[model samples]
Structure formats: C-alpha cells, structure tokens
Target: MSVTPRTHVRTTALVLPAVLAAALGACSSFDQGTRGIADALTLYRPEVVQGNFVSKEQVAALQPGMTRLQVRDILGTPLVTSVFHQNRWDYIFTMKRQGVEPQRYRLTAYFEGDTLARFDGDDMPSEAEFVQRISRERKVKVPPLQATEDQLAKFPVTPGAEPASSDKGAAPSGAQPALSYPPLEPAR
Candidate 1:
C-alpha cells in the first residue's frame, strides 16, 4: 500500500514530538552531568567556619575556682552544652577553606560545683597570631602608619600651647533652652 502525503505528514508530526521528548529527557541528564563536572572543576570554595572560637589568652585567663559566668565572659558562650552533663562545657571550632587543610579544635571545660575546675583541648592560638593568620590568608592590605612619633618629633612644640576647644561659645551644663524648628511638610 502507498503511503499518502497526509499519512506521511501525520507520521512525521507524531514521530517528531516523540523524538523531541526523548532528546529533551536526554538533555536533562546531560545537563546534570555537565553541572557535576563544572562543580568538580570549580576553583572557588567558600570558607566554612563554625562554632565557638576560643583564644589562648582567654583560656589562660581561666584559672581554677573561676565561676561559669567568668569563663563565659572570657571565652564567649560555649558551643556545646549538654543537658545531662550540667558541669561540662564544650567549645568546638572548625575551619574549612579552599587551598588550605581543614582545621579542627575542641576544648572541654569541666566544672566542680559552680566553679571551673579544669580545661582540656588542643593548643589555642594567641589573639594577635590568630589575627595575623586570618589576615594573611585573606590577603588583606594593612594601611601604613601615618604621623608616627618620630615624624611628630621633628616639629617643635610651642610652650604653654592650650588645646583647641570644641565647644565655642556654647551654653553651660544642665541648661535647657527654647526649642524652635521649621514647620514639617504636609503629608501627601
């Protein structure tokens, strides 16, 4: 039997949609695969920093017989506090950044009664050293020192030079004068 022009057109119309649907379904998987590859090849990874950050100076300040409130004041709030363990506080810190090994630190502070008895954890970083480490990694530009003591020393100081007064012909303390202002614009 000879296929008519109408039959050919109907077959093509039905087959075309089926083929397109198959192609579109395949494209979705291909798109997902490409996304996976792109993600794998991505160079920029966001730095993941979490939990309570305790410094060496803060830990050093934590002496025996110190109150829980005092410990919290020095080292900030604890990251982990168990309901079961009423006298224990856990401080955990983790840092994950691109092109750097992940760092994890855990500190456990045990309390006897209401006072902090002792603490055990990895060695902490000093405030200054921690600042330097973070700044160096982020490539932050530090401004140069301006008008240093040596630079200021070059200028001779005038004898009996009174400092400049900020309040020029101002009212005396505890004086409440009359209040006046321009009328407010009417609301639209």
Candidate 2:
C-alpha cells in the first residue's frame, strides 16, 4: 500500500497537535511536581512578623485616663482599627517562624471619650523574656545576663576621680554638638 502526499500531510497535521498538547501538559505537570518537591525540601522560610510588637514594659506603662496619643506612643498604631468601633483599638501581633509553632498576641484598648478607659489582652512577655523565648525556639543559647568573674577581672578598674583630658578646649568625650542646616525651598 502506497502512502500518498495528501495522506502523509493529513497524518502529520493530526499527530502534531496531539504531540504539542501532550508536551505542553507534561511541562506544566512536571513544573508543578518539582515545585511541590522544592516546597517540601525548603529549609529556610523567612519568618513572618506582623503588627505592633507590644512588650510587657510598654503595657505596664499604660495608665488609665491616658489619651489616645499617649497609648499610641507606648504601643505603636493599632493593627485593627475598626470604623464601626471608633473608640476601641485592637493591637494584634503574629509571628510565624519556620519549624516553630506560630505565636499570636492580641490587645484591645477601650477608649472613653478620647481617653484610654481600659486595656485587655494576654500577659505580654518582657523584652528579656521575649529574647530568651526566641533564642530557645531557634535553638540558640541565651547569653548570660552578668559576665563571669574571670571575664570581669580582665578589664582594668576605674578610679573614683575622672580621667584626665588631653585637650581641655575639645568637647567632652560623649558629648555631641547640635547640628543645624538651612531649610530647603517649598515645592511649588
């Protein structure tokens, strides 16, 4: 049986589209499979920290009758400020670190006529406690609060009298002179 030019053309036309479709489908599926494997094998996922991080010290500083601005200064701008609840401000913080359970904290501040009436939330961790927690979760050792006696002995002890200054005319060691510059022209 002789295969004519017309027959050859028809066969090629029919098989080309099917081959192309299969190749495209396989490429997409292969990419998806590889993506899944890559996701599973990923070792370093960037930690996600969202919203205002209010520490125990800041929360403890909060006092009743303080203005909204004062509360805002202590704890950064609330994450959830609802239009419906104008007087209520919600500060929510979420931290998601790879290989560790997510941590979430929420604090709701109720205002009565522009004054902070009350605040309700979880017992916040102090700065030191928070650092220790993070270090523990990350499998890192927390440094000792006080230096060892041997380490402290390495440094020379200072006398009660102040250190002699080489140049009396020069500014004090820790003093910083105020800087001033001319203001720029206002934009038109």
List lDDT for all candidates, in order: 0.85, 0.87
Candidate 1, 27-114: lDDT as tens digits: 9999998998898898776778789888898888889899999989988889999999999999999878677898888899999999
Q: TM-scores of the models, in the given order?
A: 0.62, 0.62
Clashes of 1: 0
Misplaced by over 4 Å in model 1 are 1-44, 136-152, 162-188
Q: RMSD to the native, candidate 2?
A: 8.5
List the lowest-lDDT window of 10 residues for candidate 1: 132-141
Most lDDT-accurate candidate: 2
Positional deviation of 131 in candidate 2, in angstroms?
A: 3.7
Runs of candidate 2 exceeding 4 Å displacement: 1-5, 21-25, 28-40, 132-188
